[model samples]
Target: MTFKANWEKADKQYFLSAEIIEEMVRRAYTPKKLSSWSVIAGGCANLNIKINFEGNKLPSILRVYLRDKKSAYHEQKLGTLLKGTIALPETNYIGDYKGYRFAITSFIPGIPLRDLLLSHETYDMDSILFKVGGLLAKIATCPISKDLVRIPANSNGNSGFIRMAVPV
Candidate 1:
């Protein structure tokens, strides 16, 4: 897949400096040297970078959460929980660097579904939809663990103070 550095123009605000990315790379468990990096250009709440390493066959994704520690922790927990059961990438590292919480995950190679649908005029919509449906069905069948609950005890009440619990 050809990676686009869209953050160089429209999404420049979400771009991370090479130094920061290098620091994140050093903090990771991988011994591979940094080759190249570019912003993934979709997320609004976090900065996602596609990182390539020298002598490594697959690239990794580095995500810096802009929301808060809670949001970062929630995502990390979800990634861990869904690791084996789902097709999602395995998170290799999750920690704070220069006050910003980050997570590095093994990159799953593919073009984003939205990008494919928008760019290709003759794309196979039926097959794509079927695959998506199957994936969703599999996800639905996965049991939710009780220990994963993060909602407040009183959040599900009719009281005005609490309305609904939103998952990160």
Candidate 2:
């Protein structure tokens, strides 16, 4: 019962009003109206929304940091550390709107990994899992300085956006 209540509250707290999304779109891209937007399923941590801009050159995702901004910083840092090493999208902007920390990232166009993994025998499961294990091991062994989690007052990374990262 308590878990249900807590989840219900999270549902409420994480909602994004159209006005807020409009502002996010304007700042991240041009001042164009949103063609459509939808909540991405699966994640239990942060909330990701897929938004369509009428004629955007590339699709984009809006990630709302739930739980805390520290997690947001961690994710952004991981994206930086793993770029080119993995298949994650590029982050365009990281900022706050009405107190919620958010990021705008280029959407990677592909089928979900889970679907691909389960859909066919064409994939080498063992090799894939081994590679994934190696990646996780690398992340686990990597030294995370206090700086990795420390929110810099005004820092930038390949940055098109200002620094408002939250400290871990």
Candidate 3:
């Protein structure tokens, strides 16, 4: 999704509120003391915040889905499947908060690939692409569980929402 479209479509209700943050922390079974919060920019499908809890050195990410629960469910399922295989943030919680679906996961450090590609002029693009290709290769080898629902096909071979590299 385009940055403008995603930003404009972002859910205003998902803005960081004391109550919501508290609830997210509680659901994640984290310490009550909140140290800091910062908006994490990049993703177009969700609003994210990196939250630091008191006495904990590592931060956690709160992702508020801008789409329907189905999108959240799809993400959660994919995360679960890729947990140990991929270097993904550990998912802590996924549930409805104030009528909006949200997920809390362990915070991962580093700039997003999109931002790096946009800002850097002389970076090693080949190396980065090779790494990403390796990661995708690993994901392709993973055995998908039978319980997980596959996305229905479309005329253009794209899923209803996100485009898939392989035919779903």
Candidate 4:
């Protein structure tokens, strides 16, 4: 979808009324630079914005809350604390005024693994399978602990395979 259309879609989903948006811009925008702005890939929960200021690029991911203050605060706190400890995106900036809060983050590189696998033209008879296996093992062994965060009992952690344990 077009960028404006995508922003509108995100606004509707996140309950961002035009009045609210105008107010946010008025409060946040400055003549030389916008306090916050938009990025290329705008996500559902957060609208990513890249701002150019004084010849330095200050890119930020803007998270528009669908609800009131408390929900936004909780989301920001949890999200900020969880950064680096886990493999999630990093939050760089946070701002709240006029009942709307936004978050900014540094974008990461690398295409999705699913896309990579799907884009492969053919399955090689050589080391392709071995490389895939190694990648899977690396992902599986990534650091995780209950102390770090609670893993919901219902969550399958994005697994598509049948889960089974073979005792050694």
- Alpha-carbon TM-score of each model against the true structure: 0.71, 0.64, 0.73, 0.39
lDDT of 2 by residue, 54-73 (tens): 87766689988876887766
Candidate 4, residues 1-168, lDDT tens digits: the string is 112333333454344554554454445544444444444453544543444344545443345653444544565544444443335556554567565676544555555334445454664625765866765565454343322343333464653322232333
- Please, what's the RMSD in Å of model 4? 11.0
* lDDT per residue as tens, model 3, 117-143: 666377888998899999998788665
Best-performing candidate as measured by TM-score: 3
Candidate 4 lDDT at 90 equals: 62
Each prediction's number of clashing residue pairs: 0, 0, 0, 6
Worst 10 residues of 2 by lDDT: 1-10
Cand. 4 TM to true fold: 0.39
Candidate 2, residue 155: lDDT: 48
Residue 109 displacement in candidate 2 (angstroms)? 3.2
Order of models, best TM-score first: 3, 1, 2, 4
